[model samples]
Target: MIERVKKYIRENHMLKAGDMVAAGVSGGADSIAMLHILKCIQHDMGFELEAVHIHHGIRGEEADRDESMVRKICEEWEIPFEVYHYPVPELAKEWKLGEEETGRIVRKQAFFRERERMGFPEQKTEDQPQFLVALAHNRNDLAETMLHHLARGTGLRGLAGIRPCGDGIIRPVLCLERREIVNYLKEKGISYITDSTNLSDEYTRNRIRHHVLPAMEKEINPRAVEHMAETARMLAAADHYLLEKGSRLLSGCERKDGYLFEGEFFREDQIIQEYAVLEAFGKLAGKRKDFTALHVEQVLSVSEKGIGRYIRLPQNLYAVRQYEGVHLGKTVPRKAPESTESLVKREKYPAEDFWEIPVPGSLECPFGIFEAKIFSYKKQKIEEKKCTKWFDYDKIKNSPCVRTRRQGDFLVVNREGGRKKLNRIFIDEKIPASLRDKIPVVAAGSEILWIPGGRMNEQYKITSTTGRVLELHYQGGVLA
Candidate 1:
């Protein structure tokens, strides 16, 4: 098992010399086995290890015991350890999110915190971050994930299953089966804590893990899990290639009023065209989620005419096929000039349109997902792409918020910190007046930091002396 895992790590280049890997140890068998394996190999591989535990607070005393168990194990191995103590239920309720999402959020927060603990500012010259996170997802986890996505109506990315490595995280033990992990623990005579919740079928994942995969294994092929994972791996490779081709296909589209894809776009295969439009839509929105096959088919139906009227899309985005090809833009609600109420409604942001950005967290806006994380910075080269950007953390003085432009909203211009009205920005940039109200703007206090599809304020940009950098990565936005 160890040899196979080592080979997998080698093949994947999951670790590099001088990597300070923070292993998320949940005190569960999978995590423990992962930590043990990494610990055994880390020294020889010339990488440092740290163990991090997050007490989810839902399991009461058992949760505390889990933390203690993980701590003792780390201590025995002389590993540096830290515990992220968070109230999951309270956070979930306050954020208006489910327990599952809240847990994922907190875990991500814990990982970033550990990354900050590791010394030095990451070099821009480096393709990967200096510190990396290793997860314990096994073959069963991957199989369960595939089933979960399949049941929910997923796209190609979802069907690709759990990613082994990306965004500064790697799943070293993902190549190992659950049984292999258990056997490794037994062979080494290592005792580990198990979460009581895993035995319960209350959660969707729990039910799937306990019933769905096992049934597939028994009723169908005995090697279903292995075969499914292998299939996912192959699909992931194909998806990557398709996305690259789709990007090239979508290059001709203009984002101002809406995407204007030339007739050349429709020349691709129908399957390729579906993915191509999906990518284009995602780029315009700054992130597209819950986008299903139905959405794709709806857009396709209109384009089949080679000329169609405006087709309203979900999330206020709209599409139209014309002599100029296809145009994807935000749907602007027309109002009567005679109606006073209509004029008033157009002047302000809707109550539901704005959401607060959590400190060191993520928020969902109409544009897409903006994940904010802070890290101490000593500037190396910062490659600013269209979708992702970074800012000087200390410059943001208030809780960040995401919403459509409001009256008097402005972005800072010039080194003097002079202000420019957002409306003026729109006009200056030749942005269509119709699309201004629909564009997503991220404001830190009174200052507008980023207009996702538009311009970012230069005054708040990260500098060499900046102590901390705020990474604002937007998913579903224009990508470079």
Candidate 2:
């Protein structure tokens, strides 16, 4: 068992010398064996070892006893130990999350706290890398995960199962079966606490392990975990290829509106395009809920027409049809005018509109237009929330074109009262660099007049006796 773990670690380049490793001990045979083998390996591998025990506060006195046992073991081994004390039920309620997610969050918080307390922010020494959190997931757990995802009708990504290494976490004992861990614990004659809740068939995982796996072992092959693990590896490789191809295909289809797929793509092959769309859309919405085949079929059914339409999905996401395209995304509500039925015909514009010159007026950029305009106030009363603005036309240039920010743009901000580059303005506003190019800036020659959601140039302002009233309003393009 130890040899298998060692081989897996070596293959993954998981652990290295002088690394501060922490083990998540849940008072189980798998975790105990993990700690034992890790301690043995640390000496030869040249890494530091520590243990973390979390008291879920659900098991009453038994939980306290578990913590005490863990502390004693760590003290005997001369290793640093930490314990997280949290109210599980309260956390579950406040976050509107399940027991598993709450437990994970608090335990991670405690681990990082202990790590920082142990002089973190210290870079790796010449001998090794920094630190890593080690888990004790065995082969049976991996198999169970695959089965669970399959039961839930998950996508190909879920079939890849539990990863051995991801970011700061590593599972060195993932290659070993649960029985080997129990045997290892017996060989060492080490006594560890076990949660009584694990015996009860209340949890889904426990039920699967006790009832489902045992029945499978009786009727089917006993080496199910091994076979499943092998299948997972093959599926993971195939999943990688499909993901790459899907992503490449999606690159052309991806748009701000949403991703568009040709309906014929799903009919062609095993790599289902409908599943790909749901997966992609769910990711965009920051979720991975098991969107079923039924959901994909519904999305496909609506997109057969040429005109665009919106279809609400399981999550707070939408599937919309476009001109010769269909997309799934978050739908932004269209703003309608007072007594207006649709978005397009809501805003009333005059065919013949002209205004006399007046003082400077503040104008907000319309939905599609990025630049704010300054013109003479023509209308008597205008709502602050309205996209249109009336500015004093006489205070500024006679004719200025509304456009996006050009390179080498400069602005004299009112707040700072100094000339600064548009790039600097974007940085000061903390606008993500990727979005800076898309931001609209009103410009006259080399001077930037306005940056929406940011500072407006102080140079242009309403003055007294401005005759020409300039009505600055957004025209053409998509409404924001």
Model 1 scores a TM of 0.67
Under the 3 Å rule for N, CA and C atoms, how many clashes does model 2 have? 23
| Tens-digit per-residue lDDT, 254-294, candidate 1 | 56676776667777777677777788678768777745555
> Per-prediction TM-score, please?
0.67, 0.62
Task: State the lDDT of candidate 2 residue by residue for 1-480, as single tens digits.
Answer: 667778898887787877788899887788888998898777878888899888888778888888888888888878778888999867776675456668889988887887788776645553556678899898889888888767644666678788788667899998888887888888889987777878976555777888888788778988887888888878877877886776655666676867766545445454546546655766677665435544566566556644645555545566666665666677643531211111121133332221221222222222232223232332223222233433455545644544455668888776456898988877886666655554454556667765533455665544454454444433222211
Q: In candidate 2, residue 89 scores what lDDT?
A: 68
- In terms of lDDT, the poorest run of 10 residues in model 1 is 336-345
The regions of model 1 sitting more than 4 angstroms off are: 119-123, 127-129, 254-258, 304-308, 314-316, 330-480
Error of 2 at 304 (Å): 1.3
Off by over 4 Å in 2: 96-101, 112-131, 256-258, 262-275, 290-295, 333-480
Worst 10 residues of 2 by lDDT: 336-345
